[model samples]
Target: MTSEIQSYNFNGASLRTLTDGAGEPWFVAKDACDILGMSNPSMAVTALDKDEVAQIDPKDYLGSENRSNQAVNIVSEPGLYKLIMRSRKPEAKEFQRWVTHEVLPQIRKTGGYIPTSESDSDEDIMARAVL
Candidate 1:
C-alpha cells in the first residue's frame, strides 16, 4: 500500500503521520513528543501507566503495571475529523475538556482511532472504549 506522510502543528506541537494499509493518516502522540525532544515525554506515559492522567489508555505502554488501553486511533469521518481539526489548537480550557472528555471518548467508542502500541505489539486485554 502506498502511503503519504505529512506533518502539522497541533496544540503548539508538531505531529507525525502514520498511515494504515489504506493510506489514511493518524498521529502518534508519543512519537510526536519524542520528535519534539520532550525532556519528560515519559512522564506523561508514566502517568498514563499509573492512571493519573484523565481519559488516556494505560495499555499504550507495554510492561506497565496498570496497562489497559494501548492504542489511540484517529477518526477520519468528516464530522469527527472536522471537530478534531478545529480543536487542533484549542484556545479555551472548556473546549479542551469537552474534546478530552466527551468528543474523544465518542471517537474511541466507534473505533475511529488506533492504538499507541508499537507495530505488531499485542495486548492481552484490548483497551475498552470509554463510552
Candidate 2:
C-alpha cells in the first residue's frame, strides 16, 4: 500500500509526517523532538509514562529530500499529543492548536480515528465510534 508522507515546518523547525496503512498520521520522533526543542530526541519516548512508552513505535519514511528512507521512532496520533505536552517551548501550544483545531479534525472527517486521549488507541477510538 502506498503511504502518503510529507514534511512540515512548525515555527521554523522541520518535521515529517506520514499516513500509515491504517490511515494513521505517524509523526517522526526526531523531527518532533527537534521542533519541540528537546535537546535529546531519544528522551521524548523515555520521558513518557510507562504506558505511553508502550504505545509508541517506529516507522521508516523518506526524508525531506527523499535521499533515502530511514527508520525513526514515531508516535501514534495519541502519542503525538503526549510528546507535544513534554515540550516547554511556547511553540508547543501553537503546535497543539493547529493540530487539534485543524490537522486532526480533517483527518477524522475522512473516516479516520482522531485519538482523544492517551488511553484512546486508534483502534479503540474507531471501535467506539462504530458502536
Candidate 3:
C-alpha cells in the first residue's frame, strides 16, 4: 500500500533499504550513493541510463520525527545492481553477493515487507510527505 524503508548495515555502511508487497527491493538513492562513494546522489541518478531510471522513482520518506524527511530518490532492484556494478569500491562485489545470495532470496521467500509501526504505514508516510 505504501513505500517502506529497511535500514540494513553492510560492512560499515548503513543502507536505507525498501521492499514492496511483491518483495522487490529498493534503496534510498542518497544512501546508495553514500555507500558507493558518491558525493551527490541527485546528480548521479541523472547520469544513470534512461532504462535504469525507468524502474526507479523519487519518493519522500518519513523520518524518526514522523515528518517527511528530505525527498530521497528511490532505486529499484535493477537500479541497485546497476549502481553497484558501476561502482569501483572494493566492497562492490561483496555488497552484491549479500543482497543477491541472501537479502533478496530471503525477501522473495517471505513475500512481503513490514515496517515498524502504524506511523510508517504507506498512507501515514505519504500523508506526511505531502505536508
Better of 1 and 3 by TM-score: 3
Give each model's whole-structure lDDT: 0.41, 0.64, 0.65
Clashing pairs in 3: none
Q: Which stretches of candidate 1 lie over 4 Å from their true place?
A: 1-7, 28-69, 77-80, 85-131
lDDT of 3 by residue, 1-131 (tens): 14566677777778776666676666677778887776778887886766454333333343452344345576776877788778777756677677677766756986433322444778875564455
Pitting candidate 2 against candidate 3, the one with the higher TM-score is 2
Model 2 agreement with the true structure over 1-131: per-residue lDDT tens digits:
12456667665677777766766566767777776667776667886654333222233245344443444566665777888876778757787777778767866786553435578788987786686
Ranking 1 against 2 by lDDT, winner? 2
Error of 1 at 112 (Å): 24
Residue by residue across 1-131, what tens digits does model 1's lDDT show? 12344444444554545454665554544543343343444343442322122223335322253344554432232322333333333343444465567657865786454333245344522442242
lDDT of 2: 0.64
